[model samples]
Target: MPSGGESMLESDNGTLGWLNFFHKGIGYFAYTMHRISGIVILLYLYLHFFVLSNLLRGGVAFNDLITSFTYGPYDIFIVMDILLSLVIFYHGANGVRLMLNEAGYGLKHHKLMFFILESGAMILMLLFLYYAWQVLLSGGGV
Candidate 1:
């Protein structure tokens, strides 16, 4: 009989490991990205609420927070904002694709659908970044 450690190792070997999960195929990649994007958006929601709660301290506090975002050193926040927007766009678009697949539309062409979804997401992100860059150069906040 195999030892306990040997049995455990066997099971682990048969399972999809972390590196394998990423390298399997486009479906796995899309699934992983969807999960990661969901988690990021959830975390961003908490941060958004925390920032909004500053209003409880009155207009000055809120304005200070807003002002910090508009200045020189805080320009990084604009970049983060754009990244968050891209994540949101990707998650939302992929979600719609998933819904369509669930409804039995394009089930046979899952790989192709994933490619289209990813391409669309990239295009949208690029357009968004372009607009955001224009705004930033014109001295605007995200």
Candidate 2:
């Protein structure tokens, strides 16, 4: 018989755990997005804490940290903001779906409802991007 560690490794040898989970169905897609978005939000929380901690040094230090993202050459900040917004939407929407199912509502049409939720999420994302672009054009940042 295989050792415990060997068996565990063997079980996953042909497939990546969560990536394989993606192929299952809409339910799995919702599950994976929820997990991934939760992780991203958690990491962003850690980053927010670190950024705020800079304020402990002085207002100047904090402003400097903030400037690095808001000023030139770091479109990454806007990109991350967009992505974070999208993740937050997906996570919250999926949570609502879970809550609905738990309450014995929409269990049969959960997939259709998920698509509807995702469409709304996409609209919100586009609205965010439009405003961010306007801000950029207004010389709010370089």
Candidate 3:
């Protein structure tokens, strides 16, 4: 038989080529980005909930924070908000599909669910782009 390196080269030349492996690597990159974005969104949700819970202390502090958020560093906030919206939407929609698949629904409707999830993500992304443009035009006032 051929040596180990030669066997690997044979497989690489056969079906499991380097190009296919590169594409698969890209898929893993997308998956990792999705996971990381989801975690960031979850962290934001926790912070949001914590702030809302502060409504217990009457309106002044919360309202002040809200006002500060509205007018604060417009450029930074606008970019961050747009990015966060995309991340949260993608993460949430993709996460539901993942959960459904994990519960075995995927076995029943794998392609259908994947299409649904992908379409939903695309729609959300477009909506976010539109809204982001609107916000930018509005100078991030609202």
- TM for candidate 1 is 0.74
User: Candidate 1, which segments miss by more than 4 Å at Cα?
Assistant: 1-20, 140-142
C-alpha lDDT of residue 133 in model 2: 76
Could you tell me every candidate's TM-score relative to the true structure? 0.74, 0.76, 0.53
lDDT of 3 by residue, 1-142 (tens): 1111122123333542333433434233334455578679889889889879978877998766655565664346656776787787776765666566556565455446656776798797888789857765595454
Per-model root-mean-square deviation over C-alphas: 8.0, 7.5, 10.0
lDDT of each: 0.69, 0.69, 0.59
Ranking by TM-score: 2, 1, 3
Residue 30 in model 2: lDDT: 72
Over all chains combined, what TM-score does candidate 2 have? 0.76
Q: Which stretches of candidate 2 lie over 4 Å from their true place?
A: 1-19, 139-142
lDDT of 2 by residue, 1-142 (tens): 1111112123342444544544467766676567678999999999999888888999887776676776645658977887788898888777777776667777768788778877887788788789877876786644
Regions more than 4 Å wrong, model 3: 1-23, 73-75, 99-116, 125-142
Q: Which ten residues in a row have the lowest lDDT in candidate 3?
A: 1-10
In model 2, what lDDT does residue 37 have? 89
Ranked candidates, highest lDDT first = 2, 1, 3
Which candidate do you rate higher for lDDT, 2 or 3? 2
What is the Cα-based lDDT of residue 15 in candidate 1?
41
Instruction: Highest TM-score: give the candidate number.
Output: 2
List, in order, the clash count of every candidate structure. Answer: 0, 0, 0
